[model samples]
Target: MATEAPQRSQLSLRPLERDGFTARVLRSLTAFIQTADLKPGDRLPTERTLAAQLGVSRSTIREALQTWQAMGVVQIRKGSGTYLARDVRATSLHVPVTINLERQAVLDSLELRRAIETDAARLAARRGRSEDVERMRVALEEMEAAYAEHGFAIRQDRAFHEAMFTASRNPLYLQIFQQVINRISDAFNESRENPFVTEPYADESQPDHRRLYEAVACRDEAGAVAAVTRIIDFVESTLRHDE
Candidate 1:
């Protein structure tokens, strides 16, 4: 006799309102991405499977998946299982704990940073004023001081980057970067305020800042580009990652 296949078991998200099912699904999905280390092109379980895992109606899962699709977060195929889209703005920056985002988005952000910052660093090397270098040095000092006292220098870190952008002497770059900062401001605020996320990095980053300044101050365009690339590369290599 042929044996019957066992049914897949259903999971639960207790204390959830039936009406709030869709919202919960979205949050749960992103949290899974952040925690599970999911990445672009990674296949997600089927809608039926997600419905079971989330303890929600299959229709609810379908709706949430549709929303994710619209948001460019996921790609769906008729027979092939759903997948994370190749490109995403992780950190839920657009959505909302938005929390620490997944690795893909962090990598994406870093790539963007490298392009923009390297140009800025190079331009600053050519056109930067002595005052600009002074400001960077000051920001570096403040970063060191804050890192020494509080063990994390979020404000000083941002200030240094802001100063770098300003030194680029390009209003367009500054304008574009301001928007990027604004988009991440919420996540940045939460991360810095918590202190837990910022920890384990004090006394580091000093040399990178100094090197960047020296490159710019000495009018070393290629060197400035390398210095800035190194800085962003460190960030890309470190900090946030799970999948």
Candidate 2:
């Protein structure tokens, strides 16, 4: 008898909460695209399937999908299915990314991240609110907790940086930085075992985070600058060989 072909696994989906329905749905769809290697004219799963998979109502899925379709991330097909529209580079939502092993790419992304985040820290220190400071603290706590429990803590780390950027209160800064950070995260994860999963690297990162936390908490602009610089330097030296 001929052997059957291996079954392809469905793409994993992140859980969706009611509070941030739109953002959650959009993010999920984007993740699906990334995982499935979706291109223009690719038909996505039906609304019923999406609703069930996302744990949201069909109406909510329709609403979010429609919003993306309008934004040009997706094209709704009358009878076939929803298709991810053409080249998404310009129109699709950008997320923050991490360094890749490719020397040139890693250096380029690192420079962009450093430029964006260093300035964000400066702005946050200069004009952040008590609430913003509190958010940073919470994010830090989440990171520490995740680190102790999970082998890695990218999500919380991402959250902390994002909160810091938000504290800057510069919409443009936050938006662009988020885009780079999210995409870089994939590269970062692919190389995590090489750079981050080991001994000294993991141990050393905490002190850097501590310094950044202190700087932001005190709203010390110079200190924030110095702290962020140190953190970025660590990332470049340890994770990136090209820079």
Candidate whose TM-score is highest = 2
- Candidate 2 error regions (>4 Å): 1-101, 190-194, 241-243
Per candidate, the number of residue pairs that clash is 2, 17
The regions of model 1 sitting more than 4 angstroms off are 1-103, 192-199, 240-243
| lDDT (Cα, tens digit) per residue for candidate 1, span 38-126 | 67988877888677777788888887776667546788888897898844334433232122234455456556667778899999999
Instruction: Write one digit per residue (lDDT tens) for candidate 2, span 153-231.
Output: 7678778888888889986677666656644554656562546554465566766776777788898888988888887
lDDT of each: 0.68, 0.73
